[model samples]
Target: RPVCHTKPQPGNRESVGCLYSCAQCSLGGVLIAMDTAPWALDEKPEHEEVCEFRPYTCPCPGATCKWHGSLEAVMPHLMHAHKSITTLQGEDIVFLATDINLPGAVDWVMMQSCFSHHFMLVLEKQEKYEGHQQFFAVVLLIGTRKQAENFAYRLELNGNRRRLTWEATPRSIHDGVAAAILNSDCLVFDTSIAHLFADNGNLGINVTISMC
Candidate 1:
């Protein structure tokens, strides 16, 4: 909630209350915490959940991004800072990752706009413990968790008469894609399988998102 300046009318002693401002949001929006008995701010849940002006971190692929700001400013920041990422307009598309056998940790990211919302498709390759490499692919909606629940996504890899598919609901950007990769809660496979799907050093994974 935000705080707005108010004045008490004559003979209205009970209407008087102290006003407190909240400085949690980066946009410097005024949060009015009234001193009224029925408006106990402490009794409420965390403001981050209900605050429309809450801060959002950049969902850019790597750990190099250090930018964070209001929700309205995220798209512009991404457009400026991550211009290389491909942007697609359809709900079903193919994400091609070149050099699928690239050594060491690598990540590929793309933005998809559909259903009047934006989603990010991420594919990450990393070396697991014991010196084996694995790939983690996930889709994240650039919106709230409740909004993400209305949609489902699927990732499919096909080649050599073999197909690997993983279907599930898209995760919200509030829950970073990295968490899913760390938890292995996405489409995961080893280098051997990835090679099977690769054609001339390029792996094209089909991604489809649909309303639930």
Candidate 2:
């Protein structure tokens, strides 16, 4: 129901026939598009891609979560339903996931708050094949993709005299982390390497976020 509405021309006295120079979003953000049709603003890829008012789904580490709502409701939902998720402050922190060798699908979720924003860090382990286990670590911003573009994140695993690291921009909650996981765009490792980085069945990852 977040439709776009047209704006009147500077000197226009009548509503109809006025140049549809801009479209106002329901969230009170004005999108200026002189040559674009006001009716087409709803489907405009540029607008739709970064519009903060768009509906967003839960970015929790699992696919079973079906909650979806406006961007503003994300934090409240995360706080209430994901009460077990750990929250850490600062741009650099260590996310320690206990029992990395746990069998079957497992997810370790944590929230990182810095620079007046919330970031979700997810570490998941799953058996992608019959006998091979894969680990994925990714960071997601609890904001619009436009806002997410302003930040970048880094994930590092250090142990056994070796280090593995991945650095990239944080994906927006709207964008989700599924595609990144499917494409292996995040920090990925196999069970063997996971054990190499695990200390007493726990894995500690150095996570850092910064403005870009």
Candidate 3:
């Protein structure tokens, strides 16, 4: 028999069922956890709206760019402190990233502002084996993680017969361009396609961004 220094209170019936018995103290003599009501196991609260898992709506102002993110990251993301691409926000605006005639591997980063928010876009020239060349293009969001999911980017390569196009949910610039390219979210093509789209030394594309 073990000597007991403490015991469960009468009101705490939940602790009375403990297995150990103490000979010296009646209160501590028998103590064990009582079984919880079966219904307690079935009580599940809805968590879709819980803060940790909930999507954060971005506080960025303006119309064209719709952004969302986690509440914890809302401020830093809107501050636009990171550096990787130039940010631009506007409507029906066209800007050049690089000169098409420039040879070798060249990467160009630009930010476009349209409908009031900034988006990151990139143009990379890849020199292939045997002197062949390829160009890659992509659009990215500068807002939050949740914002990245709601928006879309469309790149149009205008040609005489047909137009080449690539569209995807833009990645957050926070992910870095290398990561986005590795995921193959950007448009890629060779010099032949470039030749068709290239006008003079400048290659131009019509970018259409939207939220869905």
Candidate 4:
């Protein structure tokens, strides 16, 4: 089926490409994107079935975040919904990583903007390798990794006279959690050891993001 060229859907904007932009879309919903060049019906089918109607969502900061879909979707939601969030213009931030009490899987999320870039950081909880609890923290650059070519940040858990930290380049939002975990680019810790750093459910961290 041909992509929709008639009009942008309700709650959507007319973008340059065939991509439909809608606010209600999770992770900013982008309609099926057709090739920029004319696609011929006689073109050979690819090696696999392509589901044009399939929906996709990008991860947002925190579990309660309803924003998802394409970048377009995020803009409006950010503008209208998060009016109180001031866009900071600095290189360093201190984030309080909390939620030590709730178990069986959870996530704490926060959004930070610096150096003209937006980032979504998620500290996720999971059970891996035979039900052993693990906490993973990663930062995703809103745009492609290329957009943040020289961007870097460090994640740290500082408390109880001890500190655990990891530093790396922030991945693109397109990079899912599983891939980061598999690549070992995230900050991971055992839930059992969480007590060492967590002070009454909150863990403090110093985040320093730089653009070189």
Candidate 5:
């Protein structure tokens, strides 16, 4: 008698490809392909089917529901909403420009002397940096040589001993004081003076002097 083979049902749908058996004259059977399409002659049953869609959720705080096409889309949301922002560029240093108008024509001698006295006190105190140091240096340089010399002597004497000292002479104190202020890390000069000088042609000499 010839035996007939039964077709597999949905419950046994583990194999999606076509199946074939030997001639009815023999009981021997073999799987042509383990996992292949039905169109190939050596094809076997497919164990798993391809999924059409996969569900996902938004990475937002409220567990917002949304389908993201890729992980790239999620990155921006995390960065703008969750990640901290930073800048690659460094901070800029601003310089103040001042205009000094005089009633009468002023000679370089007078300007230099005035600036030396004004900047000498500032250079004595080594607390501030940046705007303070820059402005003081500019003013001192513009003043007379005698004033610069006097300021210099004062700075050397003051810094010489553990006790602070002042000199009555006129000398350029620019180099010594500048060196001290620049070397000290904690020292920071007032920046407001720049705004004051820029707004008004008159130098904020009193403000700068008081800071020293």
Candidate 6:
């Protein structure tokens, strides 16, 4: 006996053809036949603001120059307009000595002393993080021990006023003594008075005196 078989046909318009034959057809070839569709922008998609385009401001005092909104623009202006200052790293201490060439400006001397003390305080704060062994102390000596003592007293007063506390270290005292001796403007001066003490096992401070 012979058997008869009939090919399956789509009963409805929505019916898809057999999967086995359709699987053999290339999807890329079909896509090429249907041309690339145009993108519609009738209701344009919104984009988030880029953080890079935000305005940048500089902290340099009395600077009016404004260009591209970024720190890159302000840095060059700062370097060119203002003098370059050194930043000490890794437990560095700096002492500054000022000489009184102009007489009777006691207020100015007091102000300078206050400034020097503040600088030392900042160094001491950094020392806490870097380790006490890596700390640097600077003392600025003006004319005589009396003068230096006066400044020291002022520093103590300021500390009391601000309620600031600092750890007392031998290195700090040594730097203070050295600065007092080296900071002089007079042509006739004694170099023997200034003293420097290094608390660390190693001595590595480079001291330079500028007499003008």
> Which ten-residue region of model 4 has the weakest summed lDDT?
45-54
The model with the greater lDDT, 3 or 4, is 4
lDDT of each: 0.80, 0.81, 0.60, 0.63, 0.28, 0.25
lDDT of 5: 0.28
User: Which of candidates 4 and 6 reaches a greater TM-score?
Assistant: 4
Model 6 lDDT tens row, 1-212: 10112233334223222211112123211211111111211122111111223343333212243433343444354346433323232223332323322222111111112322321221111122232222222323323223334343211111112321122221222123223223321111111111122222222222222221
**TM-scores, all models, native as reference:** 0.75, 0.75, 0.56, 0.64, 0.19, 0.20
How does model 1 fare in lDDT?
0.80
Instruction: For candidate 2, give the lDDT of residue 171.
Output: 89
Q: Mind giving the per-residue lDDT tens digits that candidate 3 earns over 1-212?
A: 22223353445434223333333234344444335322221242112222234454543221223565664564456556334444555634454654776877786656677655677677777654457677778776756557778888788878678799888888765554555556666898887788887778677777878878
TM-score-best of 4 and 5: 4
| Cα error of candidate 5 at position 37, Å | 88
> Using alpha carbons, what is the TM-score of model 3?
0.56
Better of 1 and 4 by lDDT: 1
Candidate 5 lands at a TM-score of 0.19
How do the candidates rank by TM-score, highest first?
2, 1, 4, 3, 6, 5
Q: Which is superior by lDDT, 2 or 4?
A: 2
Predicted structure with the largest lDDT when compared to the true one: 2
Question: Which pairs clash in the backbone of model 2?
Answer: none
Give residue 77's lDDT in candidate 1 (0 to 100): 88
Q: Give RMSD to native, each candidate.
A: 9.1, 7.8, 16.0, 10.7, 32.4, 27.7
